[model samples]
Target chain A: MRGYAEDKDAYLKRLRRVEGQIRGLQRMIDEDEYCIDVLTQVGAVTKALQAVSLGLLEDHLEHCVAEALAEGGEVADEKLREANQAIARLVRS
Target chain B: MRGYAEDKDAYLKRLRRVEGQIRGLQRMIDEDEYCIDVLTQVGAVTKALQAVSLGLLEDHLEHCVAEALAEGGEVADEKLREANQAIARLVRS
Candidate 1:
């Protein structure tokens, strides 16, 4: 089973919340909200999404990567490498 | 006029796109996409929102802050301080 499968519903809920925030951002712009105000909301949205990613990454490491590491072989190496790359992308983005 | 007022339509358009991305993220989770894959998409969405914030900040500085700095007084100092605080929030986020 996928690491996030158990928490799928939770993840979807968070994504929907983020979607609402994005729409709120549009309304702010349309209504001519202050620039800094919009920026502050955007920062909040960004942090929310970042939280989602971090959660998913944590799950992946706890389950998928953990299982692969326990197996002790090339598969484990590959999984670890993939996780590192994903972490790098998240950091860079 | 607010610095972003001129590009208000563009900003709204971008926010709509970000909204779409957030919805896509929900779809990904509902279908139980791989955790890493979900994380990657989340990172992309985060980057998109960050770009929007950066653009808004740039416009604010170019127009609103520029005008206040040109005036050269307490108003200018207040504007600069506000902008700096906004930037700090963005960086920390």
Candidate 2:
């Protein structure tokens, strides 16, 4: 299993919460909530999602990446590259 | 300025990379890239965003939340609540 596999339940739970927030956001839009209020909620949701992402990344680094490095060689190199690519994509976003 | 303020440049750079990945994904769709390949890229993008989110959350915890806790009292309570709410939203998502 992947490194994050162990914490999969926690990740799913976090994602579910984010899903709820999105629904709430949609509701606010439908209700014609004040623009700033809606924006504030949007910010809140974004921050929440970010937290989840960070936790997953940490798991990936500690588990998957760490294991791959211990093994060493081409696979390790590939894993490291994959991680860098992931980070690069993340930073760019 | 907040806890993440110190790493703001790094964050922005990461975000920019993600943005590029998104554009690449869009182009892939436009050019009719293989469905599986497109999905793979999408997965990559999601993971990337998650990394950025995690970094931001760490900063928030280490900086804003920590600061509030240090001060104590009503302000601390409010800050803690806000952080919990943020976490709740993230978990749900």
Candidate 3:
């Protein structure tokens, strides 16, 4: 099972909400919303997605990485590197 | 103006599609979709979001970072650091 398998439902639900927010943003743009206003919505969408990413990262660290570390050896090292890379990507985003 | 101001519409449009994909994943889950199938949708959503992130990053580098670099000085340094951090985060993700 995936690291986030336990919280799969929650993740999906959160994504759904973010998705709705995105749609709302598009509508705002279509309505010829003020530039800053549209940008604000964009910011909101970005934040929401970021939140989801953080949650997934936390879950991965708690479960996948933890499990890999417990197992030890090459797999553990790989997992650690993977986690670090994932974190770096998130930070950049 | 924001670095991505020129492609704001494109960014918004891509986000809208991602949002729809998220909704579709949710619906699939609600309908008792197979685990792997649902997970597949989740993967699709993740990839879509990543694509958007990459595009935004590209725009930032091409515009914001470039402009800042041209100005030179403290602002340029700040922009460079910000871009590096952003890239790191993306890699981690």
For each candidate, report its DockQ versus the true two-chain complex. 0.89, 0.04, 0.15
For the record, the alpha-carbon RMSD of candidate 3 to the native fold, in angstroms, is 7.6
Provide all candidates' interface root-mean-square deviations.
Answer: 0.9, 11.3, 6.0
The C-alpha local distance difference test score for the whole of candidate 1 amounts to 0.89
Ranking by TM-score: 1, 3, 2
lDDT tens per residue, model 2, B1-93? 456557656655665565566556445545545333443565665566456556656777787778889999998998788777666654554
lDDT of 3 by residue, B1-93 (tens): 665677778877787788777778677655655443454455556666666667667777887789889999999999888778677655654
Q: After superposition, how far is residue B55 of candidate 3 from its true place, in Å?
A: 0.8
Off by over 4 Å in 2: A1-93
lDDT of 3 by residue, A9-93 (tens): 8877787778777788667655655433444455555566566667667777888789889999999999898778667655554
CAPRI-style quality class for the chain A–B interface of candidate 3: incorrect
Model 3, retained fraction of real contacts? 0.18
DockQ leader = 1
